[model samples]
Target: MGSGPTAVEIISHLNSSWQKVRGYQTETEVAEYRNGKLQITKSFLYSFRKPRDFRIDMHHPHRGTSLICCDAEGKILVRPGGIGAVFKKRLSPDNRLLADPSGQRIDQTDLGLLIRNIGHSLTDQRRGDMKVTDEGGRLVVESVASDHFLPGVLTRYRFVIEKGTWLPAQVVELTPEGVLKRVVTFGTVNLLSDFPPGFFISDREDRGGGGR
Candidate 1:
């Protein structure tokens, strides 16, 4: 398949396919690339590292709560926070651990991202004409990449899929000001068939981390 893929075609190709990924009990290794360039490699345990935290919100005349996690070590990442978890980590795929101890759940729902969903990674594409640029408008940047993704505003973002992989190396969320609001870079991942039983959880040996 040549002739450059379209957005809809990309989604169709992705939805019709499923890749082999690892589970909680297994270790995973992932690799990151940028514009067909090698970036970084990381490994960790998914079950434990994937979950950051959980929350329950009982307010208004509605029942609501959410759980959050991040198994998207190497997959789609759309809209700052509007997508599902991606391909699970695959054990023995790469020579690295899959569980991550340093990761935080951040939210209540474990709704993480997938490899294909990374394409929807924009701020507000649904804002109709609200996401328009005024006369003589340009872009700004915090780093060399240029662009600051802002919060609660109409903006545009572009994600480039790496060739031969489902990973999106460079993600730039543009702000209403035309600057980058958020930029996420994917590093290499490690895949393992098995990991230590306790590697996924924090040891309760001392609940207090030398603090109250």
Candidate 2:
């Protein structure tokens, strides 16, 4: 209830924490809704390194499927699940096959992009109507905007940040009428200075069951 960190201050904290991260691995769960109904939920073991290296191991729905991109400009390598795991395919970054249920591309799902988007939304606002509160033991930052803060979506963003790490534990997006649009929850984050050799290499020879 007392005065908490402002939106700018929270953004600064997120930026500072992100700057120290050379790479990271985390479990991410995304729930998307439509017309006030929960449509789908997807889970993944998400891994990322600086300068656009990423690997996504789908844990729910598409179980054994894995997607990896070692270079920013190169195509995404996809290893499908089930019997399709025996084969591998490469597709462009904008390929529909590489998009999530919500149409978000794999290249756009990193924490760095999330933080940058939040900063952009806040900066575009003429009036700062952000509020920071103590929810349970976590810090909740909520902000509303007259126009759509994120692309064509006009929703209120609620960011629940973890205590010690200063990283987001969960992010909730709600429509102007208070309908839940999406919820992204981040599991325990493991920050690393570097990943082992060939960690992001998807074409490496392997038994290819699920993820590494």
Candidate 3:
């Protein structure tokens, strides 16, 4: 607390940790709600490779196969056939709408990217408000005043990163005044030697052009 790693150091450590994980696949469970109502819970199986290429498959409540893929060209392919049809959209890295079902933009499965975003935001300003510490062998980081939060909501985030793996175990979203909001948990993660070709593409090659 009083004497610990600086924000920069914490960021550097997190970045290094992610570098060790060349590729991985895991199941992530997300529980989210808005304005004290409209709560929903869903699970996604995510697989990722370096430098912004990944695939997410939606499970349950929604029938059929729904998939989202992000390519190196910054294009997002959404196959909403379960809910609707397939579409492609060009969006920035931080686009909130990119998060399906849960509606929260933060990449719930990729803790490293989330930490990188937070680190980028906390640079050169009042960094003293943020703190990094260790709890029960896991590294914990918290920012009292952070802009890296859910839109329209003033909340602070606490990320619990596994010390050895450098991957996130859980993310806790809380109100500025410290009331709980959402909790996202990452399930058992398994490293992959390589991502197979077409792993990040829509199953139906014929599916084309923006929204159903």
TM-score per candidate, chains pooled: 0.39, 0.86, 0.73
Full ranking by lDDT: 2, 3, 1
Over the full model, what C-alpha lDDT does candidate 1 score relative to the true structure? 0.31
Q: Write the per-residue lDDT of candidate 1 for residues 7-33, one digit (tens) a residue.
A: 455444444432333322222333444
- Clash count for each candidate, listed in order shown: 58, 0, 0
Query: In model 2, where is the ten-residue run with the lowest total lDDT?
Result: 203-212
Model 2, residue 94: distance off in Å is 1.3
Span of ten consecutive residues with least summed lDDT in model 1: 134-143
- In candidate 1, stretches whose alpha carbon ends up further than 4 angstroms from where it belongs are 1-3, 12-19, 23-152, 206-212
Candidate 3 achieves a global lDDT of 0.63
Which scores higher on lDDT, 2 or 3?
A: 2
Top candidate, metric lDDT? 2
Off by over 4 Å in 2: 101-103, 126-128, 146-150, 204-212
Lowest lDDT sum, 10 consecutive residues, model 3, at 100-109
What is the clash count of model 3? 0
